[model samples]
Target: MEAPHSIISIISSLLHIYILVLVIRVVLDLVAVFARSWRPTGPVLLLANLVYSLTDPPLRFLRRRIPALTLGSFGIDLSFLALWFGIVIVQYLLAILSGLL
Candidate 1:
């Protein structure tokens, strides 16, 4: 029981951290949209690439199924929001399974 609980706890924590990384990715992307001329270099570029690698696969899957919403000149990508909610739901389920809820 302890072993399973510990594993669930670890997974829940990792999912939470991934959500935070996704948020950072979103912020960076928004900044990039506004400041098109400001290109990331060195560490910033590396970080951006890292975030993309971690996030892209799942997002691409969602993007294929659900296109972004466009309003006039602005567009909103719903993949991130969807992923965030999915992660949270999974975390909640894990918590319940572990009897932490």
Candidate 2:
């Protein structure tokens, strides 16, 4: 049987990867918003969609509970940043629990 700390360490690593992905997703969103004419072609769009599909479920769940920041018609989706912070904290805790910190 594997050690429990080892399992926590593995989970923490996965969460770190997810946090990185979320960062990339945020950059993509910003680019899309600011660059009105910019569009992703073939493979990039496919990967973006794939990332969106993976990340959206968690974001939607968070959005329902978390209020967004808005200025008139434009609003910032706070859930993604919230989740990013949350995962960071969780990962930190996991690192401690796993005795890797």
Candidate 3:
């Protein structure tokens, strides 16, 4: 029905926004590390908190089940990559369903 198509469209839009937020989270994290000041303050702090709250739950869920890959001194968090792929897959499925209806 048209209702289902509209719902899927909304969800697809939200997923796109979520993907952008996830990218910001990754960039902010790298910035924090390179800046040598892990504790952000004022507006930066607020933004950091907002990003963390939005992205942490799903990441934490995957993180708890899967550990990061450590190569010497460097470590890679697979959860972010996994979450990104998962979202893409869901978006693809939604697109297919939308096309069908």
The prediction achieving the highest TM-score against the true structure is 3
**Model 1 TM-score on a 0 to 1 scale:** 0.89
Q: Which lDDT tens digits does candidate 2 get at residues 1-101?
A: 35786788688888978887887798888899899899988998997897788899999999999998998999988898889889989987887766643
Record all residue pairs in model 3 with backbone atoms less than 3 Å apart, i.e. clashing.
none
Task: Count the clashes in each prediction.
Answer: 0, 0, 0
Stretches off by above 4 angstroms in model 1 are 72-74
lDDT for every model? 0.89, 0.85, 0.94
Which 10-residue window of candidate 3 scores lowest in summed lDDT?
32-41
Q: Is candidate 1 or candidate 2 better by TM-score?
A: 1
Among all windows of 10 consecutive residues in model 2, the one with the lowest summed lDDT is 92-101
Residue 80, candidate 3: alpha-carbon lDDT: 95
The whole-model C-alpha lDDT of candidate 3 against the native structure comes to: 0.94
